[model samples]
Target: MRKITKGIAPVSFMEWVRQKPRNVDDNQWFQELYKQKRWDIVSDLSHHNAREQFYLCAYCCSEISGEGQETVNEHVEARALASHRSLDFTNIVASCKTKGQCDAHHKSQALPLTPLMDECETEFHFKISGRVEGKSARAIESIRVLNLGDNERNNKSLIEKRKQLSHNLMMANGLDPDEGLEDDELLLAVIDDLLTPTEGRLSPFAPVVANILRSWISG
Candidate 1:
């Protein structure tokens, strides 16, 4: 997953938070966001979060529309565990509401590593086979928590999907899956292009593809 550079909280959302009663708990206030139909504040929060992350799920790096059926305003530190952070803007992110992966798989479990950390991008290794492995202990746990398809047993579709996309990218660039390319400059350029988001959005699975490509030159 890519690091999410969180920016300022929405003005309206902060204003609403300030008005909350002293006795009210964060989770209660958070739910009231829906019960009260505070669409304006909720919309602002989702839009800002999604835009900053380039519309990718914070966990699996999948495409997301920010909020609605395709996305949920996910609390990075679950409200059940960290009740105090229930309304903390920095603790929240936009995650795909997929049934058995990413946010859905996460539930209230703690994430030892999260996109909020810069090391997150480097701690995981992505293979052309469409599988990922954690380079560190925390990364490993995070992978399992997010169900990022470390193997076919955990998530076959995601593995196959990543494999197909990354292989296609390699072929398009005239690189072999095993030997890669003899030209290091060209390889670096391709990696840079993949890492750079266009129109505030990266190509689907581009980060995973780029990660696999980088391994070629490093080896």
Candidate 2:
């Protein structure tokens, strides 16, 4: 997964925080805010995260629009585990509303590593086969916790999705993994093209495709 660089929090959300009741705990206050369906604050938070993440899920790097229906405000530290951080903007991210994968699968479980960490990007490798392998123990656990499709057997859907996207990206750019591109400078340019966001959003799985190509250059 890509490492997320969180920027400023929405003013609307902060205002809601200030209005929180003294008697209510952080967890309760957050629940009330969500339970109330305060679309203004919720939409602001979702759009902010979505824009920062390039419209991708913080956990799986899948596509997600900023719309409230498609993107959810996922607490990196689950409320059950870190109640004090319930209202902390730094602890929140945008995640896809897909079932049984990201947010839904996370539940109240602990995530040893998260996108917020730079090491998270290095700890996992996205293969052209569309499987992700952990380079560290914590990374492995994080993969399990997020159901990041460690293998085709466990999460075929995600694997297949990544595989197709990665392949399509390669073919669209005229890169052949078996033959390998010959021009070093041209290859670097292609990688740069893949990384550069268009209209403020990276194409889905663009980094995964870029990573696979990088292995060729570095090898």
Instruction: Note the Cα lDDT for every prediction shown.
Output: 0.85, 0.86
**Per-candidate TM vs. native?**
0.92, 0.93
- Candidate 2 overall lDDT versus native: 0.86
Q: Between which residue pairs do clashes occur in model 2? A: none
**Model 2: how large is the Cα RMSD against the reference?**
1.6
Clashes of each: 0, 0
Task: Write candidate 2's Cα lDDT for 2-29 as tens digits.
Answer: 7888777899999999999999999998
Deviation from native of the Cα of residue 52 in model 1, angstroms = 0.3
lDDT of 2 at 47: 94
Return the top candidate by TM-score: 2
